[model samples]
Target: MSENDTPTTVSESSETKDRPVLKLNCFLPYQLSHLAETVSRSFSKIYAEKYGIGIPEWRVIATLGEYEVVTARDVSSSTSMHKTKVSRAVAALEKRGFVARDKNPDDMREQTLRLTETGIAVYEDIIPKALAYSEGLQAALTPGQQELLNEIFNRLHQAARERDIE
Candidate 1:
């Protein structure tokens, strides 16, 4: 029989017909990634326009703001950013006089990073704006929905951790 005239059989067509299709719009991972990118870009406009800092720089500044002192490795771990990205961000922050690095006396190769006074000032200025932005986003959801989303996120985090351990 010609290919086009061949009778369709379950075995012959099953590979293509039965295979589940992935819809990017409905995919959880894609949805999450798109949401994250959108939110990050929106928030980035705040600091980028006002303070001339990008997401990486903001992550470094925020991490240092909280930890007070840390290594580039620590910032990478905390921000889930690549070490190279963290290094570049640290260098940029230092150049901007928003971050200071001190060599570890015990380990000359290691450096502790901290926010400078100017960095602290920037952090202080940006925090309220961040909070307001976050609050505005949360305001779109009802309190119950917000609580449910928080719980869902916590569970997802735990599941991811477990999967990573495996």
Candidate 2:
């Protein structure tokens, strides 16, 4: 939202004795959440239509592509997805022969996941497309704006990490 835009002032609620004046449009968390969802949905079309996979599955594939071998728990941590979602995506990928899971030697109860040859080929094909898409988005900004955006993202992420509940 731009500074010139007027925000709806929310000052009261039915059950609240003391409610802070709130402006949803200008709220940082709300704006960030909306932006993230919009970007993810828009970007998902590229992989969704081509691979018939949703956000969770694509996240798993990307994580595996980067790390080569990881557990569902590891993917969950890296992708910030719930374990259940990662588990289901891993299962779908395994069924499609894009991923292989084996019992971890270090802990037999744990499963280790890796991409198969087919998975690697698909990932290789997608990498260039992903890079091109990222470049397309970056094209909208000047080099200085791009650097500033990256810096802002890093700072915000660090702040969020520091604010984690645990």
Candidate 3:
């Protein structure tokens, strides 16, 4: 793909004009999204089947694993998941006794979620596997390429954020 001519347009016909042609393989956004989903699914297998949790649950667990405590809204924002998905995942986790909800005294309607002892154990078990999977992916790139890729990813991420605000 030409970096300068992404989604390169075809001719504007004298007859019926066709829309611009975007090759999915060459489209940056599509490529990134596809890779991310593919990687997530692949990684989910490590935790999903053994732990009986899916993507949304895994995300919530990981967040709670990191922050120790957070609201459903916080999980939604952090994981870029919709609030409904977060709600459902939280419900599932709560039912499984992997998560506990502590009622907010100030706002009875709101609750903060924390991992149960079971959840922490799962998180701890998953960490080494997660790190190994990450290391395997990084092993595909040389040190220089990995560094460059990190910089490129950060730039694109920042650009997307700016565009989102606009």
Best by lDDT: 3
TM-score of 2: 0.85
Runs of candidate 2 exceeding 4 Å displacement: 1-18
lDDT of 1 by residue, 1-166 (tens): 6323435555765656878655456677777788888899999998998888899999999999899999999999988999999999999999999999999777899999999999999999999999999999999999999999999999987887888953
Candidate 3 per-residue lDDT, tens place, 14-121, comes to 323445555677788988998899899999999998999999999999999999989999999999999999999999999999999998777799999999999999
Q: Tens digits of per-residue lDDT for model 2 on 106-148?
A: 8999999999998998789888888898899899999999999
Cα lDDT over the full model 2: 0.87
When summed lDDT is taken over every stretch of 10 residues in candidate 1, the lowest stretch is 1-10
lDDT measured at residue 56 in model 2 versus the true structure, 0 to 100: 84
Estimated TM-score for each candidate: 0.85, 0.85, 0.86
Instruction: Indicate the TM-score of model 1.
Output: 0.85
- Scored against the true structure, residue 25 in model 3 reaches a CA lDDT of 76
Off by over 4 Å in 3: 1-17
Q: Which sequence of candidate numbers ranks them by lDDT, best first? A: 3, 1, 2
Quote the lDDT for 44 in model 2: 88
- Which residue pairs clash in candidate 2? none
